[model samples]
Target: MLPVVLPLPLYAADASNTMVVSAAPAASGLSELDTPAAVSVVSGDDMRQAAPRVNLSENLSSVPGLQIENRQNYAQDLQLSVRGFGSRSTFGVRGIRIYVDGIPATMPDGQGQTSNVDIGSIDHIEVLRGPFSALYGNSSGGVINIDTQTGQQPTTLEAGTWFGSYGSWRNSLKVSGATGDGTHAGDVNYTVSTSRFTTHGYRDHSGAEKNLANAKLGVRLDDASTLTLLFNSVHVKADDPGGLTPDMWRADPHQVASNVSIYNARKTVDQTQAGLHYVRQMGENDDLSVMMYAGIRETTQYQSLPASSQSSAAHPGGVIDLTRHYQGIDTRWTHRDTLFSIPVSFTGGVDYETMMERRKGYLNFSNNGTSTDYGVMGDMRRNERNLMWNLDPYLQTSWQLTNKLSLDAGLRYSSVYFDSNDYYITTGNGDDSGSTSYHRWLPAAALKYAFDDSWNAYLSAGRGFETPTINELAYRSGGVSGLNINLKPATSDTIELGTKKRIGNGLISAAVFQTDTQNEIVTDTSSNGRSTYKNAGQTRRRGLELGLDQQFAYDWRLKAAWTLLDARYRTNACGTANCDGNRIPGIARSMAYAGLEYAPEQGWYGGAEIRYMSDIAANDANSVKAPAYSITSLNTGYKWLLSNWTLDMFGRVDNLFDRNYIGSVIVNESNSRYYEPAPGRNYSVGLTVTYAFQ
Candidate 1:
């Protein structure tokens, strides 16, 4: 039942093979050694061992009820959560559901961004937690799927670079191949990757730059058909180190915030995408699949609101702009026989998504006539045109029923819709315009038992929903300026119990869970930096999790994970006042990780790690906090295999003992500027060069 903990999974990049998880709705897809709920997988050579493969929190810290922060702000991105379900996101990623190869990097109103995942062309990463992730419809609460790296059989070329601590760097290039070996029928396969990154941040008006590109193509046509094509692009510009006031992070956790150098805060982005996938085999128990995608994105920001905070005519300014276009499609069908005699499978799908946006606002200050020019981009208060859409229909099933019992189930029927139009009318912002919609019917189930071959036990249940993101419906809880469109939608219910074992080369796991939510969507005020939201009545989350991984002597390995969460507010909470039962403001009531390794496959290699977090809760009258921290890290690497060329060298050190934490939090920042400081001792190094053609 889930948890091979974090090592053990590969379908390529062969870390001793094992993997199969198609976002787990099942019909044929399960592994974490026969999945039964919470899941994890990392691979891609453990995301480039001795990594600097650029953020994914550097290889997902041996996952355990996810929470990967790192607001070492690339202009706010990366602050994921699960279990406490996205912990009231402060920027991107909301309640999870992201995918890379089969397209969707979450949209259709849920907001997502991994700044274009390109872990140098990854090949694995699948996380799915709790009750089959609500069948992947709105805000699934957990689901991450990224897969890239396929274009096999010889022919290769790679180049890489790395550097770190404050002035950072990254560079990459890759090429892969394949052409015959698909059992005839016009074979083809390919891969391409590109990267560039730069940073000079660790606070102080943070800086950043990024560029990335990716491509994949496959075609096999004739033997049961296949086709694939995908492309990706991203561009970013950043500088926005704004958050810190717990006495300016105890008098300087890397300084910035003097209104962030007087409003020079920043952000910029551009994106491009493409996708298509198809597969067929319609005979012998049927099968079929299809996917399609499209994208466009643009963003601009610059906020540190102050020059009179846009002299309100119902101000919606401080500069922010957006443009978006999106698309999606999915179709699936699957079937297999036997029912009363057990042994079944079934799948059905339909998904459609859409987004269309154009939002604007300006005034970061500029007045000319002898005054003001703070960060330029003056006038034009706000304008809007937004639309969102979603439609889903799904079903999944599986059963074996004997020889150790098994079952899986799913159902989905999600719908979402929103529309807004406004066009900058003002005299106190008239013409507000709005629309709304939401619907749900998600269900899930699971059961598994297998006391024999390496133990297992499981149980699961589900239902989930969350829908408010248009930046939480743009502003209206009292500071009122249109579009909050009467917020409401945040349902939930979940349950889990798990167990796993395989103890020799080692693997062990445990879990216990609970969730119960209703309404639940807090934060109800923010003025200069603009934020507003409400709906909060009941909430709860209870958790416990643990994991371990092992191997010995023959190139040692060991890993560990732990989590315990409580997250609460079970009544009387909405924009403050007698919080009925606090905690749950930026979540974290325990977390831990451990790692050790001695890898092999050329020459000496090494690893070490430790992490812990606890203290967090910076609002909702829990007063304030963001302390509890422990960190340690170290890495080493070397590899060289001649013949066709291969070399890899690496190094790392982080925190080690430097400590002085608070790496993320901004929960109710009406100006208290909730911390975000992390980075004490740091270092990095890297190398990679490869060549092959056979």
Candidate 2:
């Protein structure tokens, strides 16, 4: 029997008014409320009240067991990791699945880039933790689901403007409305935003400029059903000042840019996405939801490094151009409350994706020549294409043995097929690749018991599986060596126990979990003097997470979360035994976050936040470690409410102390190292004025 803690006073409100649909019996797809799984929901009210500055990573730092590494340069990419997963990844998110209103935001190839989510349109965000996530088959770490608001009223308009330090300025406008009579309501929502952000940069030559836009529409059918359409896009242009070595960092943390130029180093990315979703109510106790989505992403980047600093001179001029395109489709069906006395729910889906990428090198005949004018003779063009398909089916059922005891069981089956081809233009050679297929069966079980309204405890066990990504598979190929087509899929089994308690006006939750993985994939650098993906024998990760949310008198609230992880490689078959007992690369052993907020009766509010992360190993060798760092932030706001109009103003200070740190570190095939750094201190202030009609 699980231990049950006291119920917090905040939960005493009317349960039927809860914003989360998954918590209600009408939504049968959910397994259990407190099933020992680390899950949390960020409500729309919280988001509006907090007024985040940049991306979701910054806003979600308060979530337990999650970490966001802001590589400072928007051109490179952001790193989001949970439960010690995806820490080693350099570009794009791995080991985690992202969903928007039940539609997968990540591509079918398991690579996710989420710069398109419009913060203004989001209704809420949900974070699901642990490897027992049979719901999403591709990743084992966690899942982040974002749901946007729809059909609020007949017509609504909102606009805002922001100005801040570093020559940063932003303008945003949104218009949403519903048409037709009550029986047939068609809704449309659109958002347009532009920002010109530049700084002398914490370091020299690190300035960046970006632009983003998103729009969506929803229709409600006469048959009590709904359909939604979405479109999102982003354009980012930035300068790359390059990374600093440890000695340089120790000497001058803000020192960047060895070869500063107006347009010498830069990156540009553009992406367009479209999706459709339909939901229908079949009966009093049954409902169905179907979703279909497709997206196209194109990115181009150029960087110039010092020729003497790099290990290999594929190009004597120290320059490289990278370009990629991605396209994919995802479809899913969700059914609720089907048959018998058993509460039954299930979700089944299929996905298909393709990617085309090429990288070229150029050498300059003279330093006086334009960067673009460099000669392209003997250029290397590596083309890789991946066709990936997967089908996932899952079933979940919950049984109520008594008023206080509940039993939940779930099972999922997955079938995956992948085909890859590589072409080399320099050697005028290419290879037609074969296809590989595999099947996985995962299961989960949980037991929850409630002693009273205030306390609950639960225990759960689940399994997860992941296949190698396209980038890792086609990274290196040659005359004597070939792709590792025989690579096995990584698998993990996890167990968790947790308890939640409500004491007075406060809520506290704690959980302990252990996950063991087999045939883990690790970067092997000992072979061919280049980094290659290899199957590590075995590994284990165990951790403890705690979360606290408290509301005191005078409208004051406090929230805090902490995570402690122990990640290690248990067994390895490398050329040397040095890899054994080493901590997993990229994963910090400890992370913590705390925030305090106060809202007085005078319509004034303010908050402060502190986040900290421990050091992380840069590679399997464990010879180098990224320094630990912490940051502080402050936010304050005021609102004035009149009879029919409302005005609000807010400001924030980020990286309050201007601490310097590296967000991510990577070593490429050339054995040359690169680091993505965190941004320096900055401030943003904005205002919103609204007029409502009764």
Per lDDT, the best of the predicted structures is: 1
Clash pairs for candidate 2:
5-454, 5-455, 5-456, 6-454, 6-502, 7-454, 8-502
* Winner by TM-score: 2
The C-alpha TM-scores of every prediction are 0.34, 0.85
Candidate 1, residues 300-376, lDDT tens digits: the string is: 99888887767867877788888899988888776666768776767677889898989898888888898878877
**How do the residues 154-270 of candidate 2 rate in per-residue lDDT, one tens digit apiece?**
465667777776566656666655564424555333333333334444455667765666666766664567666766777767666656566766676556645435235666677
Error in Å for residue 641 of model 1: 57
In model 1, which range of ten residues has the least summed lDDT?
Answer: 5-14
lDDT of each: 0.81, 0.63
Give lDDT for model 1: 0.81
